[model samples]
Target chain A: MDRNIAGVTIQVNEEGYLTNFAQWNTAIGDALAAEADLALTPRHWEVLNYLQTEFKNDSPLSIRKIGKSGVVDIKEFYQLFPTAPLKTASKIAGIPKPASCI
Target chain B: MKRILILGAGTAGTMMANHLHKELSPNQWEIDIIDEQEEHYYQPGYLFLPFDIYEPEDIIKPIRDFIPHGVNLLIEKIDRIVPREQYVQMENGDRLRYDILIIATGTKIAPEETEGMQGEEWKKSVFDFYTFNGSLDLRNKLREWQGGRLVVHVTEMPIKCPVAPLEFAFLADSYFKNKHIRDKVEITYVTPLSGAFTKPKATTALQHLLDEKHIHVETDFAIERVDNENKMIVDYGGREIPFDLLVTVPTNKGDDLIARSGLGDDLNFVPTDKGTLQSKAWQNIFVLGDATNIAASKAVSVAHFEAEILTENIKRFIAGEPLNAEFDGHANCFVETGNGKALLIDFNYTHEPVEGTFPLPGVGPLRLLKESRLNHMGKLAFRWIYWNMLLKGTHIPFVSTHMQEAGKEFA
Candidate 1:
């Protein structure tokens, strides 16, 4: 399924997750973040980059792992993306939706 | 005599039954409680069921054993409430009229609310630990688990026992370690919230503990569907999380009878006045516990507090006098952090839980927002209190309904 946001036809799943990670680009990421009322900051991008890097390596994404990677602490991770750091970070990073156990 | 009808016989309802039976003169009012189930559940104990920490005998009891001598207990499924007519329609084609009504039917897990959550993999792979049968099934599965990605997921919030899922993860960590397969299991905690908990301070404290356990946290992932064939859960943004074993807390909603009666919100929770514990829609009706859309955790402590004030107001309302008693949205809960240690938090409508000593000023047998062996002991000892004191409407000696700020230090 595709959601046309402000002239961009982005493909999303039934639940609105991106279908093809390959098709995801910076424009699509910015458009998606806007839908969630988030403005991307350099720090947000840092978390997103970290998510993308770890996900590419097939390492499980968790706050402890990310903090241990020396990117950002969990508190700052929540600060950069207030409500949901992992899911929002994954969406912004154009990776598979992160399922949590909290 | 005027009829006082109570909807459920759960924790809140049972407590109210006992409380009101003594307060209202038997000649002036007829107190009656109705529920379909014959057994009462200690819902907090469900968290331990998966790990075999509690036996069925410990939590289950005959509902009739709790009701006071004078009150009437009706065992029947409710069809709908005719509040306009001041009567209830039961599934047996009987109508129950009431001078005053109390809705304590409570919230339940709605697995069907989420897409594909109750599909082919339900009970086989995907499971919920919210019900008695669900716990039994999970226990059976956990007994033989060599272990893989043991994923614990919450579909949405406003669930009964908010800290239960976290406690489950903590207990699971201890469970696997004790089984000598701790290294074999990769545990992940998935929630839609930003951090470890709803409150900021507790979130940081819990996140610290999660980090210590080497457990992963996945945040802001709203589930879209459960792809059972693929053994994965997909989120709204199309992110897929695979699991070898999936434990989910499905969406919790009030009884369908609430929606059928047109007294509920979009999620079937009745709109209740937070302070008075009275129904905003109906003058003679009241709601408590998981059935109310009050900004409070759907906990037994909140229900107990609400019952205390509501009982007082009900008496006031009957006498054509002013109802002055109030509830401050007080919530008290224990978080089990594994290895025989737990944390206790006490907060209300205005106060967030902080570092504190409880029960006595500057002196507490129990600490708040910090883990101690004492708190875990309290959690275990609570089972005795739930049965002997709480449900019987016996007032706890020192713990008042209103939260006291004397010993707590705000950060």
Candidate 2:
């Protein structure tokens, strides 16, 4: 699926997560965050950068991992994204939602 | 003779011992399995123990009962694994070298990972069914207790038998209703995931069941601490769910031996090649089951399937042949949905469980992703197979090592 974010066409999944990380930019991230009713601050960008780094390295993301990443604590991460922090942060950061192996 | 050392005589290690003992010539190769414990536990039975459906004796047997006669069984504690030197250091100051090493020291629930989980209210108001003692204790607790708020929770993701907590909630509903206290008891399921399960199709089916059973669900809750004083679990987002009885699957981690040996990740799970089941750090060492940091579900079915592939890979390594990357993360599980019915699901790395016929495909005696009494019977019958056939590395009839796409509804 494609969505116009920040005046740019970006590929996204049904859940509104960016499918292609290569096409992600700050403007698109701002727009995605805005859609979720979040205003991205510098601290939010730090956590977003950490999530993107972990995604690029092919490391699985988890709330526990994010808590231990030294970038932000889990409480602040939750407060920043407000709901489903990992899912929302992944969307704003242009990555896939962290899935649990079932 | 060349030596093959297997760590932990649990499900995966026991099956590997049997498979290798039959496959490798005894004259050319020797196999040894080690574990500190004496009893072989039927881990799945832990689910029924809290419901008083299975007796303690039914799930436990001497570990020696499953070990093959020709294979060596060592009841000794391992201090550490010296992977670079291809040897293991025993706690008693004995060092054993191996030509090949298989680590199946499975994962265990660590209640201490969360603050206040193991505190003053540890086994009193709070409990876990992931262990034999925990389940037995909970059984006793549920026997005499009047109904109140019952919270079945998962502290984090990637826990073993991921559906067990939900199953616990469902069973509690039936249990309370049977006791004629259904109205008095409020059952709530708390999870870290966004829905009733991980996969899309299965989650939809299970969430509907939750609604039908009248079990309240609290999703996307990443717990931070258990407030024992207030009898409430507080999440990172500051959401609090109070409970009279808290049954939580705490953080699951690999054996502490992995940590002491410095061979684990942040959660003490070993890093291994998911396809080959070989340790990424050491070529001679292999890992499977809950110990490895794989994306596969940490379930017995997965270990059963991996045992078949690991046996072949071990043989290839001995013959100087390239290893076969054939393991597809296949797992077949029967989810007990209470009221004497269950749902059977078969899936792999690429496929989420969907509606289909299993084992026999279109002619299945078992249906997939739908509740049925036949599926419940299959789950009960699995106990016999686990002890008699599965541990002996026998291939289950009609069940393939890989997931089949036939008879499945994809779209």
Q: Which candidate is the best by TM-score?
A: 2
- Regions of candidate 2 where Cα sits further than 4 Å from its true position: A1-13, A18-28, A39-42, A56-59, A100-102
Per-residue lDDT for A5-95 in model 1, tens only?
6466777754467766777777777877887788988887777877877655444454434544678976677677765566667776777
Structural similarity of chain A in candidate 2, as TM-score: 0.94
Q: Quantify all predictions' global Cα lDDT against the true fold.
A: 0.84, 0.90
Locate the minimum summed-lDDT window of 10 residues in model 2 chain B.
Answer: B198-207
Q: Kindly report which residue stretches of model 1 are placed more than 4 angstroms away from their true locations once superposed.
A: A1-102
Superposed on all Cα atoms, model 2 deviates from the true structure by an RMSD in Å of 1.9
**lDDT per residue as tens, model 2, B1-411:** 999999999999999999999999999999999999999999999999989889999999999999999999999999999988989999999999999999999999989889899988889999999999999999999998898999999988678988888888888888888889999999999988776676778776666788888999898888889999999999887889999999999999999899988998878888888789998888899998888888788899999999999999999999999999999989999988999989998888778888888887688878899999999999999999999999999999888888889988888
What TM-score against the true fold does each predicted structure earn? 0.82, 0.95
User: What 10-residue stretch in candidate 1 chain B is worst by lDDT?
Assistant: B192-201
lDDT of 2 by residue, A1-102 (tens): 888879889888667877789999999989888889999999999999999987775566779879998899887887888868988898899987766543
